[model samples]
Target: MPSSTYLTPRLADLSVSERPQERLESQGPQSLSDSELLAMILRSGSKGRNVLSVASEILQESGSLNGLLKWSDAEFRAIKGIGKVKALQLITIVEICRRVRERSPVTAPILDSPDLVFDFMRQDTQNLEIEKFWTLCLNRKNRLIKKVEVTSGTASNSLVHPREVFREAIRQGASAVICAHNHPSGDPSPSAADIKVTRQLRESAKIVGIDLLDHLVVGNPEHDPLSRGYYSFQESGLL
Candidate 1:
């Protein structure tokens, strides 16, 4: 709907002041809308469509600019004007954004609650197309000691062993640990495998004399059935 505000069918028809690049130079990047910013990335359009229209199509396909974080190369190429090279370019930019967003804090965060855990881990999970499990080692105060990736697996399942989960935590001298993984489908609801793995971890934690604080399933709230964005094992009284 925002793209409809552009009366001209092509960027060539717009005055220099009205153009996205010109507007960005004169008024700064913040002055331009989401579609305008995307147009700048796209650079040019196909024979019939303008770059603004192509950019608008991209936004509509992804649902929002933020939604582009989860998009794959094939998804970008499915758009009208986005070819292989453009899709690759888009993928590179998206990966850069994810890296910038997921960069760990200079001072580690206190990841006590499920909300805090979700906020801390979501960016790492954002562009993942498969399930990957990670362990967050926490000090007595619930501040992070270290974060470790335990296993990487398919879209539907990840093979996690309790030893793999606790080995790094023990090595780091962590007092407690939180384990987390992403759902590629964007629903954080735990699977049978997730429940089984949590139980195994809990029992093993008792033997290892370490706390199994929580197990989180990270996902996008937009696609989640509960719209809660993430599922926590401790919150459900399973930990």
Candidate 2:
């Protein structure tokens, strides 16, 4: 058989100017090819390959960087020269990219309908690995003033208190509030606890002098509840 890529020259043996690191530093990252960026991530390769060669092999097999999202740790490790550390690095890169996509400057909306509420928070909440509760504090005109996290809990459920939900709203001088929480199970069906919490918030809002516009549950559209993957208590007349 022809010699394995393991016998190829090490990445460090390449001309200094031609190296991925060197080019990235001198020419800016935008100047580099996708494989070159991944090469910097892979760092080096097995006996017959170099860093670029290994990164290229992975790209070819995976189709593109987006493919990395679908790959499990075991699948990453199965690639030649990829060990646990490298596999984790790739996975982390994918996660960082995903989170970056989620983050953006918050823009206020009219908050007049369930669809507006759902789309406003969906970008921040989709594909979460655990439950997270957030309160959207809005002004009297229904313009969003702030979107803040109240609590992050386990995969299936998050325990939240009315105090925790309204404390920030009160502090921000919000006239009304919208509560939202994700279901890691992707089922938007509200639990007894969910109903109880909504009623509790409703009662607390009456005392605090602020309206509870809605309590929205975010989940998978496939799980049921009209296949919308979201529920608004205000829309359903639950609140």
Candidate 3:
């Protein structure tokens, strides 16, 4: 019994005050460390390890709690104690977090500046392996009415049409629209095709009686030549 006890000092073996569930109830969720919160979710451990140690290993593999949001089911399952069911559950948890973050609030964000637009779209665009174009429909005050993905394409190119862009804006009854797309290569500089599309969109906006506020190319700062993480057509006098 002593050797077995040493081998598995599970949550049940821990003193009441030391247990994650007890601490959570007494001190609140915020009081728990990232690993402890994860331990609470995992509930148990395998072989000789305890749940807290297993949770710590998971965080170490992911680098941070935010990094874990981008992990896939396969990635979660690669860990020693994380079987198929646990992997699926973890993926579901991540998906729920993503949806909650994407839920619109009572006060919609005003995306008047390039910085604001970048921040609004960053989470949606992060870790994407291909190109995706988005249209942000806005009211007269530049507050977001809705966001729509107009197109998704390969690593190098995403087809964007003025029709698709303006159609969503018109459907939303938007007075203005901001267009954004990501470069998987991490360079935010607009390609020749991007410029040509923007010119076409500028003309279409006039015909449709909708303002084209800007066209933004999003990329990571480390890969962007300008290191700005994004390039704005309006700021460059292109729109």
Our tally of clashes for model 2 stands at 7
- lDDT-wise, the better of 1 and 3 is 1
Estimate, for each residue in 145-187, the C-alpha lDDT of model 1 and write its tens digit: 9999999999778899999999999999999999999999999
Which regions of candidate 2 are displaced past 4 Å? Answer: 1-107
Candidate 2 vs candidate 3, TM-score winner: 3
Which model, 2 or 3, shows the larger lDDT? Answer: 3
The candidate maximizing TM-score is 3
Report the C-alpha lDDT of model 3 over 80-104, residue by residue, as the tens digit.
7888999899999999988888873
Q: How many clashes (backbone atoms < 3 Å, residues ≥3 apart in a chain or on different chains) does model 3 have?
A: 0
Lowest lDDT sum, 10 consecutive residues, model 1, at 1-10
Tens-digit lDDT string for candidate 2 (57-175):
88888999888777877888988889999999898888888777677555668786778888888887778999999999999999998889999999767999999999999999999
lDDT of 1 at 32: 96
lDDT, model 3: 0.91
Listed in order, each prediction's TM-score against the native is 0.57, 0.56, 0.58
